[model samples]
Target: MTNTMWVRGVEWLAAAAADPRACKREWDHGEGVALLEAGRFWDVLSVPERLGLLTLDLLWRPGLPVPGPTLVDTAAGRVGFLLPPDPSGGWVGSGLRCASRGSWVAVPPPYRPARYLEWLVPPDGSGTLHGPGALEDALQQANGTLAVLAPLCGR
Candidate 1:
């Protein structure tokens, strides 16, 4: 990531940590680990649908450099990462109880695409490559595409 993107990511992460609802934790398997979790994290996203997709996509993306998780306090709730039972399998919220973590925790498979991908792509501060925009005008688009997909999905 570019320095600007890294700074932006750090700023966002820091803001997330500051939220009242944020929760922080650490995990170890003879190694060190950290995670962040937020029950109401959707509030941080400009678009809920995009937030869902971006989150799932980031978790599911292949070969991502997995950052050690961390925790932060935030207005909405606590946010932190939990260790996966099998590190290779990635993270999922399948049967995650509001406050449960560790071996007993049930999680979804990693390969499945999230249900929210049909919604608008979240803006990385607003750009075609980062957010959705009209090709001709190149203007940034703000609305989530959920409305368009909802009727089709009969939601």
Candidate 2:
């Protein structure tokens, strides 16, 4: 079944991309994660969608290395992506991969505005962050949270 929340998130991203101010304020990694954790952002996207957003965020950031590996913390785990390396030293945009999964997934070209919104947040709201090695712990915590919030989420 298609996830309605993911669809809504894509719509939100498209609208934000059309407005420069909205894009600037809404697309930051930290801020996006904050909103997701706070239930203010869509959080039902698939893992691939989440990775796609992370890759796009890196591309949008100024002065960040492109076509390289980057990692971020999420409620799921420490996800990573490798933006495809530029060819001829020119801007060659492509897809990325999540380190946790190690699978290359294609993203729409940067010119396109169908980017996914960030939905990965720290497992807990206590400001303590975990990494790839903490996957098991994260899963346990997530299960606990799900048990409590599933009803609230109408799941």
Candidate 3:
């Protein structure tokens, strides 16, 4: 994309927070990440890096649409998927975490590089997000696959 397009995409992503200006201000100060409240714009599905890597591959595989923006929190050893908020809140698993209403997540500018947290898949600025059902299906498939293969080296 042209530089202008990516810049707009970054703005689009930061707007997910209640205070997009504050997020932008944080970035202006050279911070690599900003805290954003979940549920309003999207929910966060956080899982172990191992599961995240496998799940992402499945989501991007041949017939499936690519998953939405995903974050890898290296310091936290977790990967977070940005998903459309689900009012039902049915997600539950051994090592999975779903952050919806009343929760917050640290996110990076989708267009920038960061240390602890980086985007595995950045938002396209169209407001598309990972489908909850699709993500769950991918996670389940990944869980089964991990039993035999060693975890891939994560980003």
Report the number of the highest-lDDT candidate: 3
lDDT of 1 by residue, 1-155 (tens): 45565444334433333331221121112112123333222111111334333343444345843322222223223222322223233223332223222222111111111222111222121111222111111111212344466689897
- Per-residue alpha-carbon lDDT of candidate 2 for residues 1-155, written as tens digits (9 for 90 to 100): 13554444334433323343444345343133112111121111123334334433534346733222223334334343322222222211223222222222222212222234222321111222222223323334544555687699897
Candidate 3 TM-score versus the reference: 0.89
Q: Model 3, range 11-119, lDDT digits (tens) per residue?
A: 8888877778888877667676888888888898999998998999899987777678898988988989989988777788989899998988887787776678888
Best candidate, TM-score: 3
lDDT of 1 at 107: 14
lDDT by candidate, in order shown: 0.27, 0.31, 0.84
lDDT, candidate 1, at 71? 25
**Candidates sorted by lDDT, descending order?**
3, 2, 1
Off by over 4 Å in 3: 150-155
User: After superposing candidate 2, which stretches have Cα over 4 Å from the reference?
Assistant: 1-102, 107-114, 117-130
In angstroms, the error of model 1 at 140 is 31
* C-alpha lDDT of residue 79 in model 1: 29
Q: What is the lDDT of residue 155 in candidate 2?
A: 73
